[model samples]
Target: MKTKLNVGCGTDIKPDYINLDVADLPGVDVAHDLTKFPWPFADNSFDTIELINVLEHLPDTIATLEELHRIARPDAKVMVRVPYWNSPDMLADPTHLRSFSERTLNFFDPAFPECKDRPYYSTARFNIMRKSCYIRFFYYLKINARFLTTPLFFLARYLGAVVWVIEFDLRAAKSDNK
Candidate 1:
């Protein structure tokens, strides 16, 4: 059976997923602190995992990503959503420890320039598959969200605050160690 994990799934539980959160909510299947290292699951335990609007709340982004990578099966797909770096929504919540942009996840991509030299930065490797952006004021208008992250990703470099949230689909790289 394929195992799927919904990390930081507060109250939104999916019957198909093992819901996890720090709070002992009714839907949480595993109420464990996310900040702590070595999640309860064994290595390469999950084939699919998601962190919807959860990355920003964690204190250590890289560490959490690494742990997620450790528990994921080879080439497992991981989805993450976080408040856009320039958006006020990131600062609106006191629990938000950090904000992210279209390029923020690139730090975990071993092929990305930022991580090429810093081998010690993070051991986790992910190949970014797709990225999308959400604009709050224009929520009703579905103005080509893909462009915000494609060749026109440069737009965020200048007018990033306009973006409310950024979502990424990543495929975990195969690891020999695992």
Candidate 2:
């Protein structure tokens, strides 16, 4: 039986997933503070993990990712969704600790050029299989007005939103080299 985790799941819970949260909420299967180190589960305990609108709130994202990498099996698929850096969703929320961009995850992949110079920043590595950006519906008209005149149009069309969110499907690159 494969383990599926919904980390930081609040009111939302799926049937089979272990709904983990800091609060002892109604649907939570495991109530533990994610900010704490060495989560209860053993290493390589999970095959799939989802972080839906949860990463930005973490105080230490890199540490959290490292912990996730510690728990996930090699080639495990990890899904992450975060508000785009330029989006109002990222700014309006006082609890939001960080913003993300297309290149944010690239820092985790040592194969990426950005990490080539400073590989020691993170020992964990993941291969980003897919990423998508969504645009804010209300800002469509305003953004469209500048479509051909500025780069924002091209960025908006391909990247997504005045209140954009980005989703990434990452495969943990765990190996004996670690």
Candidate 3:
């Protein structure tokens, strides 16, 4: 069977996924705080990971990403959804520990100029195969509720919601030791 993990999966549980969260819930496969190291899963065990509205809540983004890298299969695809820094949703959440901008995830992009000297840089160590965004549907509908039933809604999704999706891949670094 394909192994899929939903990290920080609060109430939204995907049927096929191993729903993980710090809190106790009915279908939770794992209930451990993310702040600690060494997640329950074995190294390179998961094919896909979903972090929906979760990254900003982690106290240490670098450590969290490192753990994510440790658990994922060599060429895993990770989907992350976070509120844009400027959006009200970002600030409204009292538990949100970090704010994200366009460059937030790019820190993992190898081509980024400052990857060499930065201590927190991980993209240089992992290959980023993809990156994209999507605007929240509710946000679009709020801006133009009148256009809700029109094709413009679809156009907005195709054209305007580019900053939202934030999808990417992280390839494990080739080790010289091997």
Candidate 4:
């Protein structure tokens, strides 16, 4: 049987996914703190993992990624969604502990040698498979009106708040070197 795990599901639960969260909410299959290791599920159990608005909440990003890697089957596909560092929504949340840039997810790429290194070096390890930026017009308007007398549409493209989704394929490290 195929399995899908959704971390930090909050109140949104998909029929096909095993909804998990630290809080006890409706449709939550497991209510456990994510910071703890060895999540309730078995090792190499999930074929797909979804982390939406969850990574930024964890204090230990590397440990959290390792736990996700432990539970995911080899070649499993993982999807992550997070607000851009410049986004107001990202800063408004008190629980958000980390800010993400375009290269945030690249650290998880198994091909990168830095993956074997400590969590602090994660950003230097992974490669980006795909990325998209979402910009809010309201934020752009505010910035243009306050900071610039003229409409700086170009500036908004670069400085506007963004929402990003990144995908990665997790694979076992090559054994030839070891």
Candidate 5:
């Protein structure tokens, strides 16, 4: 059985996974605010963790991601989805403390220049397996087609307010020490 953790699950509760949220909603298995440090789960506790539409609301991006790394088991899958920085979706939510671009997550990868030159920023390491962005057209039609991430579409997104949501699928790189 897959031991999955739905962090900041909010109203999207899952039956089989461990659902967690800030409020004690109907099916929320844990009601702890994610902003606090040292989550109740043990280190290396989960096989898969989902942070869909969650990271933007947190104040400390690096610290919060590091905490996720601490709990994730070796090669565990970490799914992150956040509103694209240039989109109105990011500004619409006042609770969203930060915005994210496709390059935002690369800072945590050791091989990436963002991390390689500044290793002291964090110990967290994750290999990005895949990344994609969705474009929202007139707040109604959403273009989540794979072609949106292609070079042409990707460049187009950067030139305008196209990509609304960005997602990253990561594989945690851990050692016995961490």
Candidate 6:
């Protein structure tokens, strides 16, 4: 059976997957603080993990990814969705400690130039499979057409607040157990 983890799942529960949240919400399997080190799970415990709208709330960017790495099985898929830096959601939510851009996750990819230049910065590694930025309006409209992504990204860069959410589909690239 394929084991899956829904990290920081706030009321959005999934059947058959381990639902985790900070609070004792309905259907939550693990109600633990994500900020704490050494999450309550064995190493390489999950085949897939999802952190929807959760990464930005964590304080330490590198540490959060590292913890995610620690629990992920090799080639595990991790889906992360965060508010774009230019989005009003980035500033609207006082709980959001950080925001993201198209290249924000590149630092964790060893194949990327930023990581290749200086790898000592982090121990965790992941291959970016797919990434997309969405406009706040289009996101609400649930229109995620690939053709619109590039144009939206371009517009968001030149004109601020065009994109609201940035989604990353990452595959865990782990070697040594530790």
lDDT scores in order: 0.84, 0.80, 0.67, 0.64, 0.85, 0.87
How would you encode candidate 5's per-residue C-alpha lDDT over 55-84 as one tens digit per residue?
999999999989999989999999998988
Among all candidates shown, the one with the greatest lDDT: 6
Q: Tens digits of per-residue lDDT for model 4 on 52-148?
A: 8788899987788777767776656677767667668777899889977655555666544444454465432223344544444655432212223
Better of 1 and 4 by lDDT: 1
Q: Give me candidate 4's TM-score against the actual structure.
A: 0.73
With candidate 5 superimposed using the best TM-score fit, by how many Å does residue 13's alpha carbon deviate from the native? 0.4
Query: Higher TM-score: candidate 1 or 4?
Result: 1
Model 3 stretches astray by more than 4 angstroms: 117-124, 136-178
Give the Å shift of residue 28 in candidate 6. Answer: 0.7
Could you tell which candidate, 3 or 5, scores higher by TM-score?
5
User: What is the C-alpha RMSD, rounded to one decimal, of candidate 3?
Assistant: 6.3
| Worst-scoring 10-residue span by lDDT in model 1 | 135-144
**TM-scores, all models, native as reference:** 0.90, 0.85, 0.75, 0.73, 0.92, 0.92
Checking candidate 1 for backbone clashes, the offending pairs are none
Candidate 2 weakest lDDT stretch, 10 residues: 141-150
- Please give me the total number of clashing residue pairs in predicted model 6: 0
Tens-digit per-residue lDDT, 1-178, candidate 2: 5499999999999898999999999989889989999997888888899999999999998999999999888888899989878777788899999888767888888768877776787888889887765554555542222223234434754643443677788998997434
TM-score of 1: 0.90
Ranking by TM-score: 6, 5, 1, 2, 3, 4
